[model samples]
Target: MSQLVSLNLPAGTTVPSHADVVIVGGGIMGTSIAFHLAEAGVRNIVLVERAELGTGSSAKPLGGVRATFSDPANIILGQRSLRSFEDFNYRFKTDIGLRKVGYLFLCRSEAEMLDCERSTHIQNGLGSNSRMIAPTEAVEINPFLRKEALVGASFSPDDGFAEPEKVVQAYAEAAVALGVRILEHTEVMDVASADGCIRSVTTNRGTIQTNAVICCAGAWSQRIGEMVDVHLPVTPVRRQIGMTPQLSTPMPTVPFTLDLSTTMYFHNYANGMLLGISNSNQEPGFSRDFSHEWLPEFNAAARICAPALVEPELAQGWAGLYENTPDHNALIGASKTVEGFYYATGFSGHGFLQGPAVGELIRDLYLSRESFLDHSSFSADRFTEATKLFREVHII
Candidate 1:
């Protein structure tokens, strides 16, 4: 048997001239799709990653996996993916370190609160037991929260966070056990298409002939799509996260909370708290530098939202890039312009939580299986000139 971690494909392997399906990214989304597809009896699947597994935005995530959302489609996807995370330990035979600390979305304005009210109604319609609570009740949920400044809040008791790296590795290992080939550090330099259909993909190593291909390359999916002459409206934005040392106060089962006005979010970690804020003025390039100016802004916001988390000792921080779209929604489903080619990327900042369900949806589409949830709303064709944009505001 060959090592699954790093696939050499044996001597004279011929680079697998063809596969039943070719996945162009080895992040959690790609690995999960390959895993689910193999589980569904699609064995001749190949996943190619230009770099290491989970090293992209997947690895740089804040590890917050929750079902709290403002959109029904996203709510459904989040709920399904959350279930996968809940049963991951026994089902995948690996610990995802899931903690159901809950998610508290702080509403700072009437508009935000009304938005929360509407979204909460849709969430309840989808069977999620989330509700809008007054600022006073917000303090009850987290005594550390500064309730006076908030107008109202939304809370989902069932949602929480998990270990991202472990989960991705689990998916990769299980997918391999089920016979899904993963080619690490394998750069897919070109995607070939002809007569309005995909023929194969040409990588640096060799040619991979396949009728079906999925672009899970996150921020780079836009570039990958261009290789096949398909235009994807995904753009990259910088997001920064920070960590604090052990505080004096006992961290109450703190749920992932968002300060709506400040665009700051913080959650409890094993040793301390992980915090971050979105950078709207980010340049169109990759830079992992932890901004010092953003620190004071985030701390000030965190202190106002949750006073107990405000501490002088800021331990460490890092930054990552998100593949944001115009409407802040992911581009899913088959490409309308390119035949035999599919896409499931451009998840913006919510890729980690949505990856599992997206994988399941991709599996159903490729294997001709019935999906547990309808995904037509997220189809890539939605970005066509004939279609309108769908947006999700509650991004952290």
Candidate 2:
């Protein structure tokens, strides 16, 4: 996957003198928010990025879009975004390569199976079509897995993966066409606020005098929030995905399957498969260089989940940052102290799937309108306590 070509965007001589709203970061979240705001007829929006668009996490070769979650708030967010992803080609005139093969969470324990059942109940209650299937049924959906190792699994047919780069390209192009200016290679230097309101946004190119600023900076959100004295508790953790070599055997089409206990996941990738394993001990940083340091552990997980994965010689596929919060949930809301400053970030590993819905939510947030879901629970204020806690926390 690659970034949105700079040639495709409107080349600007310099940063605009002013804008009604300045968006920091030009990844999927930022571009999606820009598109939604433009669709709402909001003008003079400027999206400033330090580098080319989609070079961040949004450029991942493939991203899973799902609405299956235990939390009611998250379920609705995913549901709304899933609808947007479904109508993307019609609404934005871009095919995102959306494959609704489904998402199957493989369970290996009774406790995990119970949680899957409970989450499925909540998902279905909130109009999210997710169900618990027996291990045999799961194997039918994804024949690569060993049926005997599973207790049961949660399956969501409405969920699947897509080319994230295309989605980002479409959003950025559409937003720009709607009069939104994108300032590429522009770094935000400082945010000037006074009297509990925003005065202007200072960048390397120039300052944008705006009343509102939205930090869609993803992993860099912590620093962006600090500019206005807003505490956005976001941490950047390096997440890597490995691409196995092309295999001689025909790879069967399968859902984006994940191991509930191990957090090991894999799905069809070209002639081989794409794989990722959640490393709990990975340090938080902006480092995104792919490495083979975790292969042993990943192979350990594959042994229990899918033994065949251990025999392949995998290449270092890609590395991206997962904007994580203390509880592994997102931080979305306005800053009480810095009145006009708001943030929509820290989705852990679920940002792309929920980007569209967050865009609508951020629009309502900036306009002071009632949103579809109660975003109070996702506030950054939850991290003020000494110990990390949230309404719901999931590792993957």
Candidate 3:
């Protein structure tokens, strides 16, 4: 976790008086949106970041990129983003250190195993290489797992991880080259509108008049949406991850692996391992400090799943936020209440992996073009709809 290689682009001093489009948030989400819009010939694009680019959750992620999901929307988003990451080097002229070690989810019970198989069917139908596997096969793939503990698993060789910071840097750099003005250290104070449409954005630096504005504000999107009278139920829940020192006894490189029951996941990192577990008791807020407060819970779950993990002390670690929605899915659509206001937030923990394709999706939505996937199910308005909330079947 050394300092990230600087994006090294010239800085802009003044916020523009007007822009063709104003993008809030400067993480991979906003930067990717900017890149896509600029690539589509959208001019006067302005991206605003309160701090430097790639702050908050985008700054720290295990970077596990995967398309293995029970939900069609998530599966499609992941599949498309995997293709973008694969072609990123040719398009952006930078190596993102992508490791296609694949992803494997270990299931403990008949219920969990049944769910994995069911999800695998959906994944395979969407042209993914994922398939359900026996406990023995799952152990063969990762070798670190206890075969007796795992009843079943699902794996896809095409899904893997990459450096998230690099992706953000690439998109920001490319967007800047495409004439997108990125205003770092500038914070948005208010969003002004008239006649149910966006009129301008007021920031700490200055106000910029723009007809269109998209909220890519990640975990803080709830606040941003409120400014425009839009309800974007994005809550900031901190997720922590830690890396182990290089193992004394070299372990076989394995795919990104997760225990479905406990949500304890681990993957190879710096010749050691990156480990994380969801704190079920975690409150929704913006606390990004890594702590041992959840160690007891993680240790209890680790014993049940991976006995080899002897509560290894993870002294070096960082915490990041997950822009969680009520049903743990994404909110990607325009606002009916506020015209010229759009959003793409609340991916739960899937934002980083889905950023690339989502950029294109948001760009198309902005331009009123047809998107590859039907985004109706993902609209923010569904929260108030009479029907039941759309939920993702498999999550980690």
Candidate 4:
């Protein structure tokens, strides 16, 4: 399989002189948040990015957009985002190519199957259409299958994947049309503040004189937080994504399949298929280079789940970084250290699917509107003192 290459943006322009709100990073999270803010009538918003928009982790492939998560927060977040994706074509006047290919979590043990069944019940309760299918029934969903390795799985028909760049562009273009200024290839070098509130944001291009700043810098959020004396536990972890060659044999109508035993997932990638495997010893850094050693492990894991992957002459791969938090959840909402400083980062690997919902939440919080979802659970304050632990067993 081919390897994933790093694509960084050119050196950004100098920071702007002034703006009402300054947002750092122009990935899916930043653009979505900017779009929602513009929709909420925050006209004078400035989004600063070190490189071209969505070139970071957002540009990576295997865009599986699913709402059938084991965690309630993830389920709700994905559901809201799915609505936005369904309406994206009309909203942006551009086809983002969101295909409802479905999601299936392959179970390995009775305990895993029970957890999936329980999660499916919760999903149904929350108005999400997800069902637990037997191993035999799963083959109907995807005709080609080695039934021995598979037990049962949770299937969500409405879930799917989309073009990441198109979605990011749609949000950016829409936000711009609404009077939001996005400064691409512009880096925020220093975050200036005073008296527990933001004073200004200094970028490579120029200094944005804004009391309000949203640090959507993804993996680099920890450094930004340090500028304000706040210790955010967000870190960057590398994740590899791969696509297998289009087989001559008719491919089954496969849902996004995950092997519970190996934490590896493979799903339909456009016309072909895409897969990803977790590394227990992934180096922690900002590097986006693909590793050759990881592919064999991923291939073995994929074959164990779907024996079809063992066929030679079919595989391509790429790697990207995931901003992970202590609990493998995102850190959203206002900062307890600084008053006007807000943050939305550390989404782990689920950033793309959760983008729109997070955008709406940030918009509501910024505009002082009543939000339908309770975001207090996602606040950065949870890192300090006692708090509730959000467990999401279904992660790949």
Candidate 5:
């Protein structure tokens, strides 16, 4: 947690009056879009952030990356994102701290194990090399796990974790180098549209007249949608994490392990462990205050799943918001009602890992070119349909 490599916009840089594309929210999603758009030869692109980059949920993620999803679209997105992270260091000259040790998802019940098997089958079909493993094999992969506690587990060697803040900064710096204007501390007041198309974006700095505006605002996406009269179904749910004090003894190299039954997840971080448990009673809003009441429950879960590790004192903990939707999936692509407005929010808790591929997809959508990944399933229009929405079952 040392000081992040500076990637801020130059001092006293003025906001432009017009641009080809305007992106709101400077988190992983927005910065990723800016980088990809600029890489694709879009020069006059502006990314405006109300705060510093990665100040939102992007900075608070557990940094888990996996392709073991029930939905094919999500699996494809994960695969492409993994590829991007693999090449990020070479492309950006910045190491994103990607650790591809693996992702181990443990299921306690037979029903959950069946779901894992089904998801693993779908993932393998889509070129994801994830597979259901025996409880003993799960222990073999990560010796710290309690094998008796897991009914089954699915693991993907290609899936792992990365430094979220570093990834965001890398994307922002690369975007700046490629001619994308990044305006930090600039609040987007309103998005003015005429005849169902974006006309201009009024911000605290100044008004930028642009035909296209991408809403990558993480937790604030709903408000951004309101600016354009689009009812984006996104809510901000607070998620908290606790970091244990660095252990005296060297711990086993563990993958990002998640107990699917309890929704408790943890992974190795530095010389300690970073862990969190999903609060079933968590109310949706923008409040990010950390609560100590959940500590006992989280401790119990850790004891059950990882009995090898003693309950070390929590060095520190913090809370962050998740841009959740009606379904746990993200809302990507253009709005049916708004002609020039695009969306790339509501990833629930998976935005950071999926940010890179989403950026490419958004760039393709903006240019009206064929996307590398099919994004029809992620359209904003899906919410209006009577059919059941695709929910990601592997969410931690």
Candidate 6:
């Protein structure tokens, strides 16, 4: 595997007055884009972040990475990302804590089983190693699961999880080593464009003269787009996660398991269990305050799906934002209204896993090179018409 030589700048470096390309957001997505752009020989690239890198939703993800998806686009992206993670330690010289324990989707109803079958068929056709399995087999893979609640399941052994913060640091350090400049604690105040073309970007520290800007702001993407008069259909939805006290027994070697009926998921973390459940009642906003109000719903689902975790003392918890779109798919590609302005946000809740692939895709689009995968499905213009959008079925 190829590796990028580090050229990181000293800490507290001054911000430059100009750059060839100015990328907003220092999270995983922005750093990935910056690294790929530098690899593509784009000189004088600058990445500006309002806070420390990975402090946003990227730092708080479950870190699940998988190729099993109902959509071919997502499957391809996930597969490519998995490859990157597999080579991360050697390529970036950093341990990302990648574990290939796999992903298990338990289906309790016939309708859910059918959905899994359909998704498995689509995934298998696209070279994904996902397959449908009987309920007994699911228990064999994850002995802690309640077999009575699952009629069937779909699983992919290639799926796993990683450390999101480590991934971000690797990308940022590598990008800097390749001549990319990173400006932390710098906020983009406004974007200046004329005649539908980007000219420069204004930040609280200073202004950067550039012809291109890529918004990878995640949950704050809507506000970033508003600076240039483009309406981004992204909303911030709060998702909470809880961690249980260390178990007295050894942790199970089970995959990251999800109950399809309740959208509850859990996986072993160190000696404890990390768990979370999707809440439809979560209002769209930017508030990330963690709450224990959803403990009842989580405990109920745990009793049915993962009985061993029932009534486990919750030791810690957190809330993070998901940049969601109407279709729950990502928004990528260039904007029609703003020339030289591009976006690669709105991954719903899967941005961390897709960051590497999306970065390459954005680099290809910006450099006028043919992309490795078709990105028309994720184009921003898809929402222009009243057409039905493609939705991913395996969302947790």
Number of the top-ranking candidate, with lDDT as the measure:
6
Question: In angstroms, how far off is 85's CA in candidate 5?
Answer: 0.6
Candidates' lDDT values, in order? 0.81, 0.87, 0.87, 0.81, 0.86, 0.87
Write the residue-wise lDDT of candidate 5 on 149-243 in tens digits. 98989998998999898888888888888888888888999999999888999988789999999999988999999988887789898888888
Candidate 5 local Cα displacement, residue 337, angstroms: 1.9
The digit string of per-residue lDDT tens for model 4 on 1-396 reads 111122222345444577888888888999999999998788789888787888887887647798887778888999999998999988889787788988878897899999999999989999998998888888778654567778788889999888888888888888888888877667777888888789898776667788899989899899988888766688888888777687777666687777777887777765677767786768788888876656677767757666666543447778788899998988888877787899999989888998999999999998888997888888878877443333333331
Provide the clashing-pair count of each candidate structure.
Answer: 0, 0, 0, 9, 0, 2
Say which prediction, candidate 1 or candidate 6, comes out ahead on TM-score.
6
Q: Which stretches of candidate 5 lie over 4 Å from their true place?
A: 1-14, 308-311, 387-396
TM-scores for every predicted model: 0.91, 0.93, 0.94, 0.91, 0.93, 0.93
Clashing pairs in 5: none
User: Residue-wise lDDT of candidate 2 within 1-396, one digit each (tens)?
Assistant: 344444233444557788899999988899999998998889999999888888877878999999888889999998999899999999889899998989999989999988988999999988878888998899888877888888889999989988888888899889988888887788899999999999899987778899999999999999999888888888999998889888788878999999988898999787789998888778989998888776777888888878887755775489899999988999998887887888999999999999999999998887778989889999887776433443334332
Query: Candidate 2: minimum summed lDDT over ten consecutive residues — where?
Result: 387-396
Cand. 5 TM to true fold: 0.93
Q: What is candidate 3's lDDT per residue for 236-255, written digit by digit as tens?
A: 99888887777778778899
Kindly indicate the candidate among 2 and 6 with the higher lDDT: 6
Off by over 4 Å in 6: 1-14, 387-396
Model 3 weakest lDDT span, ten residues long: 1-10
List the candidates ranked by TM-score, beginning with the highest: 3, 2, 6, 5, 1, 4
Positional deviation of 115 in candidate 2, in angstroms? 0.8
lDDT, model 6, position 21: 95
